[model samples]
Target chain A: MKKFTCIVCPISCSLAVQAEGGGDITVTGSKCDRGKAYAKDEYLAPKRVITTTVKIDGADIALLPVIGTAPVPKELLRTCLRHLYGIKVTAPVRMGDVIERDILGSGVDIVAARSAVIKKG
Target chain B: MREITADIAVVGGGPAGMSAALRACGLGAKTVLIERDAALGGILNQCVHDGFGLLRFKKQMSGSQYAQQFADAVYESSASVMTETTVLKLIPGECGSKAQSRQGLYTTGEKTGGALIRAGAVILAMGCRERPRQQAGIVGSRPAGVLTAGAVQKYINVEGYLPGRKAVILGSGDIGLIMARRMTLEGIDVAGVYEIMPSPGGLRRNVAQCLDDYDIPLRLSSTVTEVHGKKRVEGVTVADVDAARHPIPGTEVFVPCDLLVLSVGLIPENELSRDAGIEMDPVTGGPVLDNFMMASVPGFFAAGNVSAVFDLVDYVSDTGEAAAEGACRFLGGEALPEYVTVRAGDDVSFVLPGKIRRDLPSSALYMRVKRTIENAVLEILADGKPVYEKKHPIVTPPEMVTARFHESAGSGVPDAGGLTVRILGD
Candidate 1:
């Protein structure tokens, strides 16, 4: 059994996670339904973001915060990085700008996280 | 496609939705509150923090307590609160959008779609959604552990789960800072928080109370460049970004961690609004409204996060009450002055209630900065006349700034017909 705290609300509950007889984890100490679902997801198939800076080839700036639209599988993050090597974009990068779509064919896009100037210097 | 109606239909059930519903019902309007979730509380239910309710309740309380206050008020007001009711579309009715259709497989007996009651006014308090890593342009490898700060909050606070044992946060928004402290209490090592800007995206109190007090390291003018690891987030590389947002060649280092938490920003949920054909401002991501907070549709009004993202729940409640009353007043056939529109000028990032009715009962201006400035004076301009200006000590890009232009601040203005707010630096 592992003790954990729920991160969904401020009432971060001290929870006990134990593997039941059927190889399933049971979560205790959730304050609400949302927490309950989150606990289950955390125990099974944990999801998260894919963020990285994309190199802008021609812009005065070197990089921009690029991220995937959704969480890729927990295992595929490395293969995803191989795709961005030597990749670059021109200047005047806008927030929400897409640098590469379906990056590495991983069903995720590398998008600009913020707007940036191409360059004047 | 069925028609359903109420005396007053409130969209959303967060602080604003509840406040509006309670006020409308208190004022004797048959109210219907619609929420997209199975529960009534909007983001508050997930916010386990205790800083809320300072202004309205006159006491600092937890988000749940604050939400419960409205919940109890709602119950006593005898308002009909519908959970998991996503409003599919808004069509004109006998009052306005007299004919409307909502789709839900369940709630047929309890909800009874296609029923008619005929609301005279409508209040929209749909709240907002967080901007994802894509929207924020966070750089890194695709990994399993990075989640939005709010999502992290939901996972840890609500469900009793730990997202990670060691974590790195991108963006110092309130949630990120709050989570920084939260992770510490859980004995999780918070690797660091990185922001491209020199300042934070949250309030001064949050910085001092949540981060400084906890001994969490917050790096400014820095950003993460890549996510490392094959399956889970093993670590990230932090680098300094120049004034032009370029990575400095020599300023890169790798910080190993299992989780990355994002506290970027929020976008108002406007899908239903768009389906209803309400006009939206591209910048604010919400419906343009008259001073009454009423949208372009005559009887349809918006408030709270649905109108624009706000820093405080107090403001949400304030706007929510206004929307409720506005709905009642409209339904009662109250006459309003023709509203003139308000615009955010060059220095301004965006303003809420993008439109103003000529016949406004009361007006409140909410705004954020296009970027950070210091030692500035706020100038409220009306038809090119300086109406209200105040000296400010410091301003940051992320923190929202608010100044009221009620009757008290009147500068002998003749153009009460139309007005706008502007900021100038000393």
Candidate 2:
């Protein structure tokens, strides 16, 4: 049996999972149905990414977020950072504003996490 | 400015607000519920979970079902509910105002603009929100698949879209824990929940119910130090942390995953409250209230999650009732003495009901701890006396500690003294 913890909502469930014969797995201990679903996937595959701010021009603030809308592959973080280093946004950014959709065709969108105004001089 | 008057005005149409309005109307107050949303239910609309009404209803209920019942109860009441209306400000009522009585509200905004409904009382029931990823210092290759736990839940439950198949999550908060199970149910790959604390930030039942039940590994005192990917996420570098919380060298390992969900923590929604000059308690991110749940400004009352994040809906409702009554009592000319003052003590993260009047009955003090302890004693001291103390077999930061007092200790005059809570005998 494998163990996993669901930290989604306040109902953190300590899950117990057992792989059956094939890709099928038995899950228990989830506070809700979502926990079970989380268990099956962890054993099969896992992925995630980092979301942060990038420098912007002609805005009140010098930085805006490029939050990940999807998880990128695990090995190419440095490569992605190099690309972001060369990127910059113009002023008047809104929270949740999409910066790049299907970024690099990774099926993810980089969005602003918070709103910032272009400072009036 | 416009003038309007109601017996009771409840801000926020969430569960607490709706329940408060329903209760107030049932108590013979003509209630008016003002919701900023197009609908009455606030965050509950996005919360599609099932463990919502367990304590309030003594039965299992989905978030939507519980919201419907509360909405129905409010509908049945004589209280008037105005949706998509924002309460911009509160002021002295016209004509009725003099030194003896203060005008309660001069409201402005799209929904209830230019209307002054003299609410005999008011209840503030604003809710909380999630902290974003950038604050967590999760460095990674710029790509996608990172989102707050709440957003993921809303996207799947409300918008009916799948975020991704593979996933990794940072922070083992309740939302993250539950979503782990949620995404997994949709046949998506759920990676793991990582926590920087030695213990889980969520309730123990959640650790047991959500993660333990599903076989998801919880890396305690660990973190997602780096994200790996180019156009998309390919993996994450998770490392164990020592007591100081710095990642232990040589312990770094890479895990491949697609989606990352964060459930770091919640902060009270206080932008409006702050702008209104309400005195706030930094510890709880809420406001300082006397026994009546009234803020520094008269007629400006706060309750429920807006005041502080509550573990159960029952407490939210309980606080909401007090806010309404406090507002009404003030308007009705009931004399409530001012508390000398309130203060937070050592071992105590913070306490609610920051003050109490001499005439007011002793109130409930809600707080949490700074860390975990075994065989701990939570002691409440008033006027330097051991007013109340309780020993628990165990105490953790995630679970809130609640202690109430109804009897006055000495002069019954709060201004004459003060109170403090300390943890001992661990």
Q: Which stretches of candidate 1 lie over 4 Å from their true place?
A: A1-121, B1-4, B92-118, B138-141, B359-361, B371-375, B407-417
Return the lDDT, model 1, position B233: 89
Model 1 residue A111 lDDT? 71
Best by DockQ: 2
Q: For candidate 2, lDDT tens digit of each residue in A1-121?
A: 9876664444356778888896678888876777777777655664444344467787754455455656676344445545665778887876558876776667877666544567777
Over B236-292, each residue of candidate 2 has an lDDT whose tens digit, in order, gives 889999999999999999988877788899888887778767889887899888878
lDDT of each: 0.72, 0.72
Candidate 2 positional error at B224, Å: 1.8
Give the lDDT of residue B288 in candidate 1. 83
In model 1, the Cα lDDT at residue A104 comes to 68
Off by over 4 Å in 2: A1-121, B1-3, B88-120, B139-142, B408-415
Candidate 1 structure quality by residue, lDDT tens digits, A1-121: 7655565543345556777897778888776777677767656765544544456655643454455677776567556655664577787876567888887676787676544565655
